[model samples]
Target: MKTKSTTLLLTAITGSLILLLGSGCGKKTVMPPETTMDGGADAGTPISYPAAEGGGYSEESLPIEGSLDDTSTATSVTAAEGMAEPTEEYKKLYGRSTRGLSPIYFNFDQATIRPDMVAKMESNSEYIRQIPNAYVVIEGNTDDRGTNEYNIALAERRAQNTKQYLVDLGTDPARVRTVSYGEEKPLFFGQDEISYSQNRRADFIIE
Candidate 1:
């Protein structure tokens, strides 16, 4: 009876050991893997961010050095600088219409050409000399300060004087015709000295 009791005790202890071992073996301890800049597999590869929906980046929104608007504005300014106003000599060389040329200004109530206008007369003569077949009509004008008849007469004198000067400078006398607009066609509508001065002038129209 004593031997049997010892055997039963030994069996119970062995069963308890087996149950603990089985329970320990059934459970598993899992550890998460380490992640680097490039996911987890490759160390040298670079990680790429997923692109947003629609377009990537606009010219106005990009982090570029110069913006598109700035570049366009710079180009426009450069183009404007390249197209400077043409000089009188350049206009003459290109045979541009005298109507497009700057008018010769005169003093108030004066039919006589001013001393300062001599250079302009010379330049006009030079332009006419270059074009032998080109005929020019000198339109004389005056401010509204004088009577219609008086202004008309003054304008005629101004036109005649301008024509004579051009003829003296080797331009053909027949090619230079004269007309008087009197106070009819004013270059400026204002009633001021500057406007009157602009109105009292001879306009050369190339024909």
Candidate 2:
């Protein structure tokens, strides 16, 4: 009986030790993979890699250094001071008018027609009606304050708005073309709001 008790005690101790060891085993935590300077994958570094050919990774891929496809060096463009930029292709399409309205100025950043300009536009419409096949190019402009491209769009809108007003007043839609010069053109050169307001105008070119 004593020998049997000794064997049972030994077995119990071994079983308890195994239970403790099993409970002590911990879980492993995984971390994100890293990126290398050569746009390659690293086990611990984080970075972005450019798309490879056929949309897969290759260690031999070359890294892009600076401005890609830079063409400023090929065609050197130097703008003249206090001068309006060259007219766009669309503006070039319709040159100076043989007969049309005089240059009409607008309030700053306004595309709406003033009460006083109504008579002038009415008279202009009559002149356009007199000549069949007479087309007019409306040029929109703004002061030099905003982005060049944005001003171009704004100027274009001003021209288009003026053209639409004329169309509503019986001018032929087919005879009208529009261009936005944006902030590129100004009769008076300055940074003041008054100069800007003066530049925000529409001019007509009859053809």
Q: Pick the candidate with the highest lDDT.
A: 1
Per-candidate TM-scores read 0.53, 0.49
lDDT string for model 2 (35-150, tens) is 66665667455655666789866653534332223332222222323333223222222222233455566776677888887887788788888877767888888878778987
TM-score of 1: 0.53
lDDT of 1 by residue, 1-207 (tens): 999999999999999999998788565878645445756654555444444457553433323333223422222212323433434243323222364344576788887778898888888788777887988988898989979999999999999998888888888998989999899876567899876877788878888
Highest-scoring model, TM-score: 1
Q: How many residue pairs clash in model 2?
A: 6
Which residue pairs collide, candidate 1? none
Error of 1 at 93 (Å): 17
Q: What is the Å distance of residue 104 in model 1 from its true position?
A: 1.5
RMSD of 1: 18.7
